[model samples]
Target: MEYADSKCNAYDTYASEAKLYPCLPPVVVPSAPELIRVEGSAQSYRLQKINEIQKEIATERDKHANLSKKYHRAVRIVAGVDNALVVSSMVLDATGIGVLSTIIAVAIATEGAAFG
Candidate 1:
């Protein structure tokens, strides 16, 4: 506009240029807290470790209960077999001495094997 002779055009160009200039001051962003952030990260890690131990304990309890059930089942089978042997012994009492003796020997062998 320096070369222009008209005052009106020069004023319009100056007005437009002034509008491009910044009116408000620059913004200042706040800095983050370094020590506090570090502490918070450590605390979260500790909580995660504690939670993992609790999960392990719950799993162990379930394993123990399952093992107990299997042990009881084996005990029941042993008891049933022992009872059958006792009933058979009673019925064989009047048989020939030789046969009765053989049954008794077999029963003793079976009981010893089962008890072991």
Candidate 2:
């Protein structure tokens, strides 16, 4: 029988034995303590990364909360101003002063200028 050696060349083994058993090269394995140390280091690294990510998430949540508050406040202010405008417009229309027509003409002119 013939088998490939470490150099990958096939050689006959039948002269010494009728049967040949395939064997693999010996492998060097780490000791238990070495393996534990490596695993511990990896676990610590992962935990550290997790903590950093959690902090970043917290920061972003705070930013989002602040932005949401500001947005709501602006919406409320705009709504109040719109209500005031409606009341004023009604008062002007009821007074028979021709101010509403003037305001409408000005608004139309401003709109045309802005859009064009």
Candidate 3:
């Protein structure tokens, strides 16, 4: 009888504990995914602006490089033409024959025209 009473008492205790600690609805805390999504949106917006600024900087650099190259090329061309003219004049002074001078002058004129 005592054994049966003990078994019954154990079952009753378990049942009372289950009833006392009934399952409750979970607290409605914001999910980690929701918080992460909000942060991600803000970060993406900042990154996009940074990327746009970087692109603009790259374009400006390219334009500057192109202009520099063009300027250098123009300087080189002018220097070469000036040197050629000086050499031609020296040669003409050295060779004082009339026919040869005429031919050389004509050639120089044509070269000048082509280069200029």
Candidate 4:
């Protein structure tokens, strides 16, 4: 009985001297409603930015289309003028007039200067 009592007392003394470590507190979290509101606002902002980008792309596409149309029209006009020059030169050569060669040379030089 005396030995058992001594052993029990020693255990109690060791238990009292034991060191305890502190634990970190749990992290705080937002409620469901608050989370929903934050997410909704973020989503709306993203959507608005996407729409702005889309509008910019559409505007650029329209500008490109207009430029393409102007370029094609200019090419057609140049082609028609070139054809007219060829026909006039042919008619002058076929006539074989005395001053026709000089006139043809002047016409060709003028066309070259204007185009080049």
TM-score of each: 0.47, 0.51, 0.43, 0.49
Candidate 2 segments exceeding 4 Å error: 1-38, 97-116
lDDT of 3: 0.79
> Taking the tens digit of each residue's C-alpha lDDT, what string does model 2 give over 1-116?
34454343234455564324434578899867544345888989999999999999999999999999999999999999999999999987787557777798899999999999
Any runs in candidate 4 off by more than 4 Å, and if so which?
A: 1-38, 97-116
Decide which is better by TM-score, 1 or 4.
4
Q: Residue 55 deviation, candidate 3, in Å?
A: 0.5
Q: Model 2: clashing residue pairs?
A: none
Error of 1 at 5 (Å): 99
lDDT of 2 at 113: 98
Q: Candidate 4's C-alpha lDDT? A: 0.79
In terms of TM-score, how similar is model 2 to the real structure? 0.51
lDDT of 3 by residue, 2-27 (tens): 34544333233454343432345578
Candidate order by decreasing TM-score: 2, 4, 1, 3
Give the clash count for each candidate: 0, 0, 0, 0
lDDT-better candidate, 2 vs 3: 2
Which candidate comes out best when scored by lDDT?
2
